[model samples]
Target: MKTKIIYLLMACILLVSCQNLNRPSGKMTRVERVVSGQTIEIADRSAAVPVLEPIRLIGIQAPDIRQKPWGEEARIELEKLTLGQEVLLEFDVQEKDRFNRLLAYVWFGGKLINEYMVKEGFALAEPDFPNTKYMERLINAQERARLMGLGIWNPDQPMRQTPAQFRRQIGNRE
Candidate 1:
Protein backbone atom coordinates (compact mmCIF):
# COMPACT_ATOMS: atom_id res chain seq x y z
CA MET A 1 0.00 0.00 0.00
CA LYS A 2 2.81 2.44 0.93
CA THR A 3 4.74 1.71 -2.29
CA LYS A 4 1.62 2.24 -4.35
CA ILE A 5 0.95 5.61 -2.72
CA ILE A 6 4.50 6.85 -3.37
CA TYR A 7 4.39 5.74 -6.99
CA LEU A 8 1.06 7.50 -7.52
CA LEU A 9 2.40 10.75 -6.05
CA MET A 10 5.50 10.68 -8.22
CA ALA A 11 3.46 9.92 -11.29
CA CYS A 12 1.10 12.80 -10.59
CA ILE A 13 4.02 15.24 -10.23
CA LEU A 14 5.62 14.05 -13.45
CA LEU A 15 2.31 14.32 -15.29
CA VAL A 16 1.74 17.90 -14.14
CA SER A 17 5.31 18.94 -15.05
CA CYS A 18 4.99 17.36 -18.47
CA GLN A 19 1.73 19.12 -19.12
CA ASN A 20 3.21 22.47 -18.17
CA LEU A 21 6.14 21.87 -20.49
CA ASN A 22 3.80 20.99 -23.33
CA ARG A 23 1.96 24.31 -23.04
CA PRO A 24 3.00 26.70 -25.75
CA SER A 25 5.97 28.78 -24.63
CA GLY A 26 5.15 31.12 -27.43
CA LYS A 27 2.00 31.57 -29.49
CA MET A 28 1.33 32.57 -33.07
CA THR A 29 -1.66 34.75 -33.82
CA ARG A 30 -2.94 37.16 -36.42
CA VAL A 31 -2.30 40.87 -35.98
CA GLU A 32 -5.41 43.01 -36.06
CA ARG A 33 -3.61 46.35 -36.37
CA VAL A 34 -0.41 48.19 -35.75
CA VAL A 35 -0.75 50.50 -32.77
CA SER A 36 2.57 52.24 -33.19
CA GLY A 37 6.12 51.65 -34.23
CA GLN A 38 6.64 49.27 -31.34
CA THR A 39 3.29 47.73 -30.63
CA ILE A 40 0.45 45.86 -32.30
CA GLU A 41 -2.85 44.14 -31.61
CA ILE A 42 -2.97 40.38 -32.05
CA ALA A 43 -5.95 38.05 -31.97
CA ASP A 44 -5.45 35.71 -29.04
CA ARG A 45 -6.63 32.12 -29.48
CA SER A 46 -5.77 30.92 -25.98
CA ALA A 47 -8.87 32.10 -24.21
CA ALA A 48 -12.08 30.10 -24.12
CA VAL A 49 -13.34 32.74 -26.54
CA PRO A 50 -11.07 34.44 -29.03
CA VAL A 51 -9.92 37.96 -28.19
CA LEU A 52 -7.70 40.61 -29.69
CA GLU A 53 -4.86 41.58 -27.39
CA PRO A 54 -2.35 44.37 -27.70
CA ILE A 55 1.23 43.17 -27.57
CA ARG A 56 4.02 45.63 -26.89
CA LEU A 57 7.16 44.36 -28.58
CA ILE A 58 9.94 43.84 -26.08
CA GLY A 59 13.46 45.35 -26.25
CA ILE A 60 12.91 48.07 -28.83
CA GLN A 61 12.13 51.77 -28.79
CA ALA A 62 10.66 53.48 -31.79
CA PRO A 63 10.47 57.22 -32.14
CA ASP A 64 7.84 58.64 -29.82
CA ILE A 65 5.13 61.14 -30.85
CA ARG A 66 7.19 63.90 -29.25
CA GLN A 67 10.37 62.87 -30.98
CA LYS A 68 12.05 64.52 -33.98
CA PRO A 69 10.68 64.83 -37.54
CA TRP A 70 10.85 61.21 -38.59
CA GLY A 71 8.63 59.83 -35.82
CA GLU A 72 5.53 59.65 -37.94
CA GLU A 73 7.37 57.95 -40.75
CA ALA A 74 8.64 55.29 -38.39
CA ARG A 75 5.11 54.51 -37.32
CA ILE A 76 3.95 54.41 -40.91
CA GLU A 77 6.64 51.93 -41.83
CA LEU A 78 5.67 49.65 -38.95
CA GLU A 79 2.02 49.82 -39.96
CA LYS A 80 2.86 48.88 -43.50
CA LEU A 81 4.84 45.85 -42.34
CA THR A 82 2.45 44.33 -39.81
CA LEU A 83 -1.01 45.82 -40.12
CA GLY A 84 -2.85 42.68 -41.10
CA GLN A 85 -0.64 39.64 -40.74
CA GLU A 86 -0.28 36.64 -38.47
CA VAL A 87 2.66 36.84 -36.07
CA LEU A 88 4.22 34.54 -33.55
CA LEU A 89 4.86 36.06 -30.14
CA GLU A 90 7.66 34.53 -28.09
CA PHE A 91 7.65 35.25 -24.38
CA ASP A 92 10.88 35.64 -22.43
CA VAL A 93 10.68 35.84 -18.65
CA GLN A 94 8.20 38.70 -18.18
CA GLU A 95 4.82 38.39 -19.86
CA LYS A 96 2.78 41.55 -19.33
CA ASP A 97 3.22 45.24 -18.72
CA ARG A 98 1.74 47.29 -15.90
CA PHE A 99 -1.34 47.87 -18.04
CA ASN A 100 -1.69 44.10 -18.48
CA ARG A 101 -0.73 44.29 -22.14
CA LEU A 102 1.11 41.23 -23.33
CA LEU A 103 4.83 41.89 -23.84
CA ALA A 104 6.43 39.72 -26.47
CA TYR A 105 8.96 39.34 -29.28
CA VAL A 106 6.78 39.45 -32.37
CA TRP A 107 7.62 37.24 -35.34
CA PHE A 108 5.85 37.49 -38.67
CA GLY A 109 6.31 34.39 -40.80
CA GLY A 110 9.80 33.80 -39.37
CA LYS A 111 10.81 37.46 -39.52
CA LEU A 112 11.34 39.22 -36.21
CA ILE A 113 9.31 42.41 -36.39
CA ASN A 114 11.08 44.23 -33.58
CA GLU A 115 14.53 43.55 -34.99
CA TYR A 116 13.37 44.51 -38.46
CA MET A 117 12.06 47.85 -37.23
CA VAL A 118 15.37 48.67 -35.64
CA LYS A 119 17.38 47.38 -38.59
CA GLU A 120 15.32 49.54 -40.94
CA GLY A 121 16.04 52.67 -38.88
CA PHE A 122 12.52 53.03 -37.53
CA ALA A 123 13.40 52.33 -33.92
CA LEU A 124 16.18 52.09 -31.32
CA ALA A 125 16.99 49.39 -28.85
CA GLU A 126 15.10 50.40 -25.73
CA PRO A 127 16.49 48.41 -22.84
CA ASP A 128 14.04 49.63 -20.29
CA PHE A 129 12.72 47.21 -17.74
CA PRO A 130 11.54 43.67 -18.55
CA ASN A 131 12.17 43.89 -22.29
CA THR A 132 15.80 43.04 -22.84
CA LYS A 133 15.46 39.85 -24.81
CA TYR A 134 16.89 41.17 -28.06
CA MET A 135 19.17 43.97 -27.00
CA GLU A 136 22.06 42.87 -29.21
CA ARG A 137 19.88 42.62 -32.30
CA LEU A 138 18.31 46.01 -31.67
CA ILE A 139 21.69 47.64 -31.18
CA ASN A 140 23.05 46.14 -34.38
CA ALA A 141 20.02 47.31 -36.31
CA GLN A 142 20.31 50.85 -34.97
CA GLU A 143 23.97 50.92 -35.97
CA ARG A 144 23.12 49.79 -39.46
CA ALA A 145 20.36 52.35 -39.82
CA ARG A 146 22.64 55.11 -38.61
CA LEU A 147 25.31 54.01 -41.08
CA MET A 148 22.88 53.96 -44.01
CA GLY A 149 21.36 57.40 -43.24
CA LEU A 150 17.79 56.18 -43.11
CA GLY A 151 14.72 57.87 -41.63
CA ILE A 152 15.89 60.07 -38.72
CA TRP A 153 19.44 59.72 -39.91
CA ASN A 154 19.00 62.66 -42.28
CA PRO A 155 20.69 65.65 -40.71
CA ASP A 156 18.54 68.28 -42.47
CA GLN A 157 15.19 67.10 -41.06
CA PRO A 158 13.18 69.67 -39.12
CA MET A 159 11.97 68.94 -35.62
CA ARG A 160 10.91 70.61 -32.44
CA GLN A 161 14.07 71.93 -30.94
CA THR A 162 14.88 71.57 -27.26
CA PRO A 163 13.41 74.18 -24.90
CA ALA A 164 16.81 75.66 -24.11
CA GLN A 165 17.66 76.02 -27.78
CA PHE A 166 14.31 77.63 -28.46
CA ARG A 167 14.84 80.09 -25.65
CA ARG A 168 18.24 81.00 -26.98
CA GLN A 169 17.04 81.43 -30.56
CA ILE A 170 13.83 83.35 -29.78
CA GLY A 171 15.41 85.54 -27.05
CA ASN A 172 12.17 85.91 -25.03
CA ARG A 173 10.15 87.05 -28.07
CA GLU A 174 7.20 84.96 -26.87
Candidate 2:
Protein backbone atom coordinates (compact mmCIF):
# COMPACT_ATOMS: atom_id res chain seq x y z
CA MET A 1 0.00 0.00 0.00
CA LYS A 2 2.73 2.42 1.01
CA THR A 3 4.72 1.57 -2.10
CA LYS A 4 1.76 2.41 -4.34
CA ILE A 5 1.33 5.79 -2.68
CA ILE A 6 5.04 6.48 -3.01
CA TYR A 7 4.98 5.57 -6.68
CA LEU A 8 1.99 7.78 -7.31
CA LEU A 9 3.75 10.69 -5.63
CA MET A 10 6.90 10.12 -7.64
CA ALA A 11 4.91 10.03 -10.87
CA CYS A 12 3.22 13.32 -10.04
CA ILE A 13 6.56 14.88 -9.19
CA LEU A 14 7.94 13.77 -12.52
CA LEU A 15 4.94 15.11 -14.42
CA VAL A 16 5.32 18.59 -12.98
CA SER A 17 9.09 18.96 -13.42
CA CYS A 18 9.14 18.41 -17.19
CA GLN A 19 9.23 22.17 -17.86
CA ASN A 20 11.96 24.75 -17.65
CA LEU A 21 12.16 26.64 -14.36
CA ASN A 22 12.30 29.99 -16.16
CA ARG A 23 9.15 29.48 -18.20
CA PRO A 24 7.01 32.59 -18.66
CA SER A 25 3.76 31.11 -17.35
CA GLY A 26 4.73 29.49 -14.02
CA LYS A 27 6.03 26.36 -12.40
CA MET A 28 4.11 23.12 -12.60
CA THR A 29 4.03 21.91 -9.04
CA ARG A 30 2.46 18.91 -7.32
CA VAL A 31 0.46 19.60 -4.22
CA GLU A 32 1.98 17.85 -1.21
CA ARG A 33 0.07 19.49 1.60
CA VAL A 34 -2.87 21.78 2.09
CA VAL A 35 -1.54 23.86 4.98
CA SER A 36 -4.69 25.92 5.09
CA GLY A 37 -7.34 27.29 2.84
CA GLN A 38 -4.94 29.95 1.59
CA THR A 39 -1.67 28.07 1.91
CA ILE A 40 -0.26 24.84 0.54
CA GLU A 41 3.00 22.92 0.30
CA ILE A 42 3.97 21.94 -3.22
CA ALA A 43 6.91 20.06 -4.61
CA ASP A 44 8.93 20.15 -7.84
CA ARG A 45 11.54 17.45 -7.97
CA SER A 46 13.78 16.88 -10.90
CA ALA A 47 16.25 14.02 -11.31
CA ALA A 48 14.34 11.95 -8.78
CA VAL A 49 15.14 14.36 -5.95
CA PRO A 50 12.70 16.19 -3.67
CA VAL A 51 12.21 19.92 -3.30
CA LEU A 52 9.27 21.24 -1.32
CA GLU A 53 8.03 24.81 -1.58
CA PRO A 54 5.32 26.33 0.54
CA ILE A 55 2.80 28.36 -1.43
CA ARG A 56 0.29 31.03 -0.49
CA LEU A 57 -2.72 31.49 -2.75
CA ILE A 58 -3.11 35.03 -3.98
CA GLY A 59 -6.35 37.14 -4.02
CA ILE A 60 -8.17 35.36 -1.19
CA GLN A 61 -8.04 34.77 2.53
CA ALA A 62 -9.72 31.77 4.07
CA PRO A 63 -10.63 31.42 7.68
CA ASP A 64 -7.82 30.21 9.90
CA ILE A 65 -8.30 26.99 11.88
CA ARG A 66 -8.42 29.20 14.93
CA GLN A 67 -11.74 30.40 13.55
CA LYS A 68 -13.31 26.99 14.11
CA PRO A 69 -15.85 25.55 11.63
CA TRP A 70 -15.13 27.99 8.87
CA GLY A 71 -11.41 27.36 8.92
CA GLU A 72 -11.82 23.60 9.10
CA GLU A 73 -14.30 23.66 6.24
CA ALA A 74 -12.04 25.71 4.02
CA ARG A 75 -9.08 23.48 4.70
CA ILE A 76 -11.11 20.37 3.91
CA GLU A 77 -12.39 21.91 0.71
CA LEU A 78 -8.88 22.80 -0.42
CA GLU A 79 -7.64 19.33 0.38
CA LYS A 80 -10.43 17.80 -1.63
CA LEU A 81 -9.61 19.98 -4.60
CA THR A 82 -5.80 19.95 -4.62
CA LEU A 83 -4.22 17.25 -2.51
CA GLY A 84 -2.10 14.91 -4.61
CA GLN A 85 -2.83 16.91 -7.75
CA GLU A 86 -0.34 18.41 -10.17
CA VAL A 87 -1.33 22.07 -10.17
CA LEU A 88 0.00 24.90 -12.29
CA LEU A 89 1.29 27.91 -10.40
CA GLU A 90 1.00 31.29 -12.10
CA PHE A 91 2.69 34.32 -10.60
CA ASP A 92 1.91 38.03 -10.76
CA VAL A 93 4.13 41.00 -9.88
CA GLN A 94 5.01 39.63 -6.43
CA GLU A 95 6.59 36.23 -6.47
CA LYS A 96 6.89 35.52 -2.77
CA ASP A 97 5.62 36.76 0.53
CA ARG A 98 7.54 37.95 3.63
CA PHE A 99 7.48 34.39 4.98
CA ASN A 100 9.14 33.26 1.75
CA ARG A 101 6.17 31.21 0.56
CA LEU A 102 5.54 31.51 -3.15
CA LEU A 103 2.51 33.66 -3.91
CA ALA A 104 0.58 32.32 -6.88
CA TYR A 105 -2.65 31.51 -8.63
CA VAL A 106 -3.12 27.75 -8.53
CA TRP A 107 -4.88 25.87 -11.31
CA PHE A 108 -6.13 22.31 -11.04
CA GLY A 109 -8.16 20.44 -13.66
CA GLY A 110 -8.25 23.63 -15.79
CA LYS A 111 -10.07 25.53 -13.03
CA LEU A 112 -8.60 28.29 -10.89
CA ILE A 113 -8.44 26.91 -7.35
CA ASN A 114 -7.95 30.37 -5.84
CA GLU A 115 -11.14 31.68 -7.42
CA TYR A 116 -13.03 28.55 -6.48
CA MET A 117 -12.11 29.09 -2.87
CA VAL A 118 -13.75 32.50 -2.93
CA LYS A 119 -16.71 31.36 -4.99
CA GLU A 120 -17.54 28.67 -2.45
CA GLY A 121 -17.57 31.25 0.34
CA PHE A 122 -14.66 29.50 1.99
CA ALA A 123 -12.55 32.63 1.47
CA LEU A 124 -12.91 36.37 1.11
CA ALA A 125 -11.59 38.30 -1.86
CA GLU A 126 -8.33 40.08 -1.03
CA PRO A 127 -7.98 43.21 -3.11
CA ASP A 128 -5.36 44.93 -0.99
CA PHE A 129 -2.55 43.36 -2.95
CA PRO A 130 -1.30 44.69 -6.29
CA ASN A 131 -1.36 41.49 -8.35
CA THR A 132 -4.97 41.84 -9.50
CA LYS A 133 -4.41 39.16 -12.09
CA TYR A 134 -7.65 37.42 -11.15
CA MET A 135 -9.04 40.16 -8.97
CA GLU A 136 -12.30 40.55 -10.88
CA ARG A 137 -12.98 36.84 -10.87
CA LEU A 138 -12.19 36.48 -7.20
CA ILE A 139 -14.36 39.45 -6.28
CA ASN A 140 -17.28 38.19 -8.35
CA ALA A 141 -17.09 34.75 -6.82
CA GLN A 142 -17.02 36.12 -3.31
CA GLU A 143 -20.01 38.28 -4.08
CA ARG A 144 -21.99 35.33 -5.37
CA ALA A 145 -21.04 33.21 -2.37
CA ARG A 146 -21.98 36.04 -0.02
CA LEU A 147 -25.32 36.46 -1.69
CA MET A 148 -25.96 32.76 -1.38
CA GLY A 149 -24.83 32.78 2.27
CA LEU A 150 -22.69 29.76 1.75
CA GLY A 151 -20.04 28.46 4.14
CA ILE A 152 -18.57 31.27 6.25
CA TRP A 153 -21.08 33.75 4.96
CA ASN A 154 -24.12 31.90 6.25
CA PRO A 155 -26.30 34.29 8.22
CA ASP A 156 -27.27 31.79 10.89
CA GLN A 157 -23.69 31.38 11.95
CA PRO A 158 -21.71 33.72 14.11
CA MET A 159 -19.94 36.56 12.38
CA ARG A 160 -16.73 35.15 10.96
CA GLN A 161 -13.43 36.97 11.09
CA THR A 162 -10.96 37.19 8.26
CA PRO A 163 -7.65 35.38 8.68
CA ALA A 164 -5.81 38.69 8.36
CA GLN A 165 -7.89 40.24 11.10
CA PHE A 166 -7.29 37.23 13.28
CA ARG A 167 -3.55 37.45 12.69
CA ARG A 168 -3.54 41.09 13.68
CA GLN A 169 -5.48 40.36 16.85
CA ILE A 170 -3.08 37.57 17.71
CA GLY A 171 -0.12 39.85 17.16
CA ASN A 172 -1.57 42.59 19.34
CA ARG A 173 -2.51 40.20 22.15
CA GLU A 174 0.95 38.71 22.25
C-alpha positional error of residue 102 in candidate 2 after TM-score superposition, expressed in Å:
0.5
The TM-score obtained by model 2 is 0.79
lDDT of each: 0.74, 0.86
Q: What is candidate 2's lDDT per residue for 24-136, written digit by digit as tens? A: 46778789999898999977566488778789999898898778888888999999999999889999988888899989999887799999999988999998477888899
**What is the Cα root-mean-square deviation between model 1 and the actual structure?**
9.8
* Candidate 1 structure quality by residue, lDDT tens digits, 1-174: 999999999999999999987443478677887777777887777799978788888887676644555566777887887788766788877878888988898877667888888787677767756557677878888789778876655555633443235446667665
Report lDDT (Cα) of residue 91, candidate 1: 88
Off by over 4 Å in 2: 1-24, 44-49
Best TM-score goes to which candidate? 2
Give the residue spans of candidate 1 off by over 4 A: 1-25, 45-50, 66-69, 158-174
Alpha-carbon deviation at 71 in model 1, angstroms: 2.9
Instruction: Please list all clashing residue pairs in model 1, or write none if there are none.
Output: none
Q: Estimate each model's TM-score.
A: 0.68, 0.79
Cα-lDDT of candidate 2: 0.86
